[model samples]
Target: MDLNLRKAIKSNVSGNSADQLEATIVDAIQSGEEKMLPGLGVLFELYWQNASEADKDEVLNALEQAVK
Candidate 1:
């Protein structure tokens, strides 16, 4: 995890519109830098915390497919 969580914090993402959030996510992935991982982890943690069990299972299934 080499992400700069502070930069995202500065962007005040809690108020982000859908497009802004999407752009942030896209930029992080496209950068392909190892340091962006912590930011992604934070995003994933947020999702995991809020997701239902079915959603978690679905995500795990897809992840399983990709990692194979």
Candidate 2:
């Protein structure tokens, strides 16, 4: 069984608008299920790839603060 999780996740949210994406993210986080992590990760990867350096730094700072 070959599962390309990133591809799958991307396909699932491909056409979503910003509000729709936010809803999806919020729903997944509220669910608190381990299975949702990969999808979140793929979403983060997409964001990271498109983010500017300043934006990336902001995200990293937020994540660092979140874990502190």
Candidate 3:
């Protein structure tokens, strides 16, 4: 993936709900395995489409701590 594009996606995640972020992360990992991480945005959008606000918050919080 292009470094600039990755940076752009990272920026899209600021203040994003946890469910949304998790879906993105999952997509990234899945795509990365296929050498298709550049397509992670689609996963993020998919998750966002179905996730509840609470689900998003929970995933986001878990992600913040996990990354630390």
Which structure among the candidates has the greatest TM-score? Answer: 2
User: What lDDT does candidate 3 reach at residue 62?
Assistant: 88
Output the TM-score of candidate 1: 0.78
On residues 1-68, what C-alpha lDDT tens digit does candidate 1 reach at each position?
78667566645668778898789899999999988777777778878999999999999999999999
**Residue pairs of candidate 2 with colliding backbone atoms:** none
User: What's each prediction's TM-score?
Assistant: 0.78, 0.94, 0.43
Q: Comparing candidate 2 with candidate 3, which one achieves the higher TM-score? A: 2
Per lDDT, the best of the predicted structures is 2
* Residue 13 error, candidate 1, Å: 1.8
Model 1: worst 10 consecutive residues (lDDT sum): 3-12
**Candidate 3 deviates by what RMSD?**
9.2
- Model 2: per-residue Cα lDDT over 32-53, one tens digit each: 9999999999999999999999
Ranking by lDDT: 2, 1, 3
Better of 1 and 3 by TM-score: 1
Number of clashing pairs, model 2? 0
Q: For every model in order, what is the number of clashing pairs?
A: 2, 0, 3
